[model samples]
Target chain A: MNPLLSSIFSTGFAFAILRVMTPLLFPALGVAVSELAGSVNIALEGIMLISAFFGVIVSAFTGSLFLALIAGLAAGILMGALLAYFHLKMKADIILGAIALNMFAAGMTIFLLFLFTGDKGSTSSLQSLVFPEIDIPLLKSIPVIGEIFSGHNVLTYVSLLAVPFFYVLMFKTPLGLRIRAVGQNPHAAESVGINVDRIKLYALMLSGMFGAFGGLYLSMGYVSWFSRDMTAGRGFIAIAAATLGGNMPVGILLSSLLFGFVNSIAIYIASLNVPSELIQMIPYLVTLIALAVFAIRAQRKRDKVGEVLEHFDPEAVKAVVKDVIETEGDI
Target chain B: MEKFILKYFTLIRTLIAILVGIIISVVLIYIISDMPAYSVRQFLLGPLLSRGRFANVIENASPMIFCGVAIAIAFQAKQFNIGAEGALFLSAAVGTAFAVSTGMPTVLHIILVLLVAGATGAIWGFIPGILKAKWGASELVASLMMNYIAYFGGLYIINSHFRDKDAGFLVSLRLPETAWLPQFMPGTRLHLGIFLAFIFAFLGYYFLYHTTSGYEIRTTGNNQKFARFSGINVVKVVILAQVLSGMIAGIGGMTEIMGIHRRFNWQMSPGYGWDGVIVAIIGRNHPILIIFAAFFLSYLRVGGQILNLMADVPSELVLVIQSVIIILITAEAFLSTWKNKITIKEAERVEVANESVAQ
Candidate 1:
């Protein structure tokens, strides 16, 4: 077999893909939740960093895994609330506020790290509580396929669980319906007595919760250590993955896996005869091309929307709405 | 006087926001430090106590002013281009590579190097802008993604072509003497690039206010549908603004390479791009005001560095202060509404008294 085919079929490579994709899945889900609610929280980068630092800090001092996890998620929620307060209460632009928060997170984490450990780098001095890996009852005993799927970090399974959890919450719950209604047609939703701002805030909170989970996984589950600015644009990579995936649960998983596979390949190819710089550029170049392709696809989709919009019957829509309103009144 | 106040409302509000930011920082310093009063005093008036420190502030502000102008220009056109960081690195690498590898007359060589750098940057920035104009891509995401690409691409070039094997570090070879920007003073690090930054700021102001193109860009930004209705090519404006923004950032990168290091260095960006975002916002996207904003930010940076060296303090306190100020200032409904409410109450009272006197 050729080297390319051999690499593709490698068992170790498959494991690396899942390991890398685990951290990304949470943030990708978070991005989906926020985008579904009409507010893009660009502060995922900062939120993950701050939460990761705090998670490790709490895990080290308390030596309690569960409390550290809660602290991480709480830190993310606090950042999310700050964004909501600025955008909702203070009337700051969401994008700009997010950028500010990101800068603050970068500076604050390092500053606090310095104060706590007296080290300007990674928090390696303190021993952090680790989230142990799990081996499936029957899967680990099987052949290569079982080896690929089992014996992963506990958070990997949590990330997998979150996808179904989000799918249900997004499509099967009343709050999810309200969020979708507000995101799609805010004026119509508001006219029906739905509180738009509250829904958006709740959506942002959920998004923050997912982001915090990702942060906790990075520090506590993935590697059991915290480093300054360790996320290293992984949050951005999550954004790219979410965007590429079309912001759906299944799509996000596939996209995360794709990017993770690409990332693993990038690492694998580093041992080749080519320059390391070229090796590093592989993932980013793919990301840029993917962006262009996504943009093109969206453009084509929008043009189709115009033709569909032209066929709208105003009177028929009014009758349908009236019938629904009459049924609601009867209820 | 009333018209003047209306004209400078953003400036006045910014000042108040900055004052509030400083007060909060003082409290933070008090909490974090053993000697709060001394630290606060040093933070406020530290740069002036030494000539070198003051020069350090000016030197640092040079790149900020250039990048700030670039951001302000892009923001004025509503492009929201955040790829200036990548554009800065790529253009400088291109400029320095050209300068070092070429053999030409002094002036022409420098001019060519600069032009190449600006064009590189403009092309680098135009990708996202054109994509947004033509296909309605999210400019923010496209620009940010482009940043990572540019960063890695620049590093690739530096390592492959410009590696100075004798430098004991992964940096580029020194450029020809023709490309080195002259120092403003014998001993200080301040160089001729600062004047270029000042000129660009003036150009930025003039470009936004005086030209017909400026009017078109602003109109397009303010209301795209209205601009289309008024026969302005909204798409072209969007693309052009980002192109210009990238070009300016690229030049800033080139100047930074020539002015400070006199060599092509591949050091990680000191985050001048992010700093420019705050500076542009603090200046309300105005040119002359951005110069002041950049200098003020640099002063705080120098003060923070001084404290870091003097008392083992982290320089990140400056960043916290900057983020708070940007957040508050950008929150128009936060402090401005209160200011307007007070002004309105005073006006109502005065009008009531005048009516009673007339009766």
Candidate 2:
């Protein structure tokens, strides 16, 4: 390959990663909010799965990408509400509810595939609305940054925009404080006049929006069509990213971008001289390693803090123990 | 008498949950599809109309019982081992691999395959266990990620190394007949896996409720600090739960393959581990209750298939219904009030009786 072409290829590879990571980012954000609120949204994978299908089907039928996006969002909220209802109201286990949603999504999507396109593994025949490209005229004039950021899918930009919004929601707003409070100490929040369950519900709803956007991107922006398990392990990757990023918006965006970068490289490598199977495993493998590293570091931090607090701050230790006890009683 | 009353109360509440679930399923079918009465009947009574189909229900329930109990065991230990799916997939592949490669006596070969499968699953589950124990990693995320690796990893192995060239499908070669699990019912799809599932559930009950280790595991699950205060090795207990849970899930995969498919294949499991997780919760991590929960789920599967054959209704409706049921049950609203009511009634009755005795 020519030197210039090789450089361009690498750049394109980098762009592909960005494209891939965009879909993963939103759901990860959703997972972050819900997890922070002490409600583990395991159904994110299922939500994305159904929403991807609905995004294409509704878009193709109506010839409106916006409508399809709305429909997808509705579908995600439905799943999220269903999950929250069971988890918060009916007292169902979070993981179990998620599992049911996953199974439901898997089967329903396949069934609908047969109902709509008569295909089991894919939905390629649908003339779905593709998200328009956002070309920043002024930004394009910039030298290095222009090429990197310009001419992307509309949802890609939205995903980027969501990061700051999530940060503000999680830290700046009363709702965000309530969500964090509910997650950290639900009883304390309850004592402070916060309805812990209600906070969780709101957090889950916000999460559904993020998850729905993820699904919309998969169908309308990333691929123009939906395939079975198309979001693949991205939902789980998002969960990993959420944890790796320490459940913060800025950290999540960076983690998601890094994952996207890894994904793009993996795709590029697979296109070249590489075994497709091994290449396929690359993204998941990276997630595993990244998560492991993040976890180890977090554990070390917790241990060090505990050690310092144990001797230096007896009152703080007592307060922490009391907080844990209160939380334990509530659970 | 107390045991009988407790069992009956459990049964009654379960039945009510099922009934409520049925009503919801009917409503969904009515809205999504067309027929109301027929679909409702099919959803409710479709599983018991035939012998073969009924057996199919039990057969499907078999692995779920294994996975559910396995999950329940871990849940009791307070270890969230979500890699039951991964464990099942990897173990199935290992079981099939051993069956093909090893030439031994019939009994030994079968036993060896099961053992190897269990070990593979245990190891797969053990990685996250060790991570959570030593590194403070979240098992939920780790196990979820590992599930994908194990799933596609098994697929890669089967497609590359064990691909049965003669078979057109993406599957491995058939195992030797000697390694096949015996059928529980002749001329039916049901196999000895059902018996094993029952044994595992009973054994799970005994192990969890009766053993010293079980007490330690339960304490560890209930509260780590408390367990630590009691001098229990919480980390070891949690890790053990994961490993043991994985072992059962591995055997679940083995029983599934050895009893049903006879070879490794892509789509080895259709979210059995996930279903097991739900079943575990619905059963409240109790062993015997898991049996009923598994049966209830299998009824839906078998009944859904029946509905598909008999009516124009899509069988995916069952999945939707099952999901709704699980969601409703887990939502906490449906059960919490009932729990509160029952608890309150018991308290009132006790106070009245004490007053009467004092008088």
Top candidate by TM-score: 1
Q: Write down the worst ten-residue block by lDDT for model 2 chain B.
A: B1-10
Alpha-carbon lDDT, every model: 0.84, 0.80
**What are the RMSD figures for all models against the true structure?**
4.3, 5.0
Candidate 1, lDDT over the whole model = 0.84
Q: Residue-wise lDDT of candidate 1 within B1-359, one digit each (tens)?
A: 54456567777789888998888778877877788778887888889998898999999998899889998888888888888898898899888888889978877877888899999999987998899998888888788878877887887788778879899988998888888887878678999899999999999999999998888888888888999999998889999899989999999999988888977776675578887888899888888999999999999999988777765567788878888898988997866665676678768878998999999
Candidate 1 Cα errors over 4 Å, as ranges:
A1-9, A304-331, B1-7, B353-358
TM-score of chain A of each: 0.88, 0.85
Supply candidate 1's per-residue lDDT for B76: 88
Summarize candidate 1's per-residue lDDT along A1-331 as a digit string, tens digits.
9676598688878988998998788888988888888888888888898899999999899989888988999999889888888898889989889888987898899888887888878888989888889999899889998889899999899999999999999989999888888877788899999999999889888888888988888888777788878777788788777877767899889888987887777776666645566655665666667778877765665554444457777765555446544643210
> Can you list each candidate's DockQ?
0.59, 0.47
- Tens digit of lDDT per residue, candidate 2, span B1-359? 33344446655555666677777667766765556678778767877777877888888999999999989988897777788998998889877887988788788888899999989988987888888888877788788778878876787777668879998777899999989988767878788888889999999999999998889899988888999999998788888888889999999989989889888865545678877887897687999999998998888877777767776566776777676666655555655566666767777877899999999
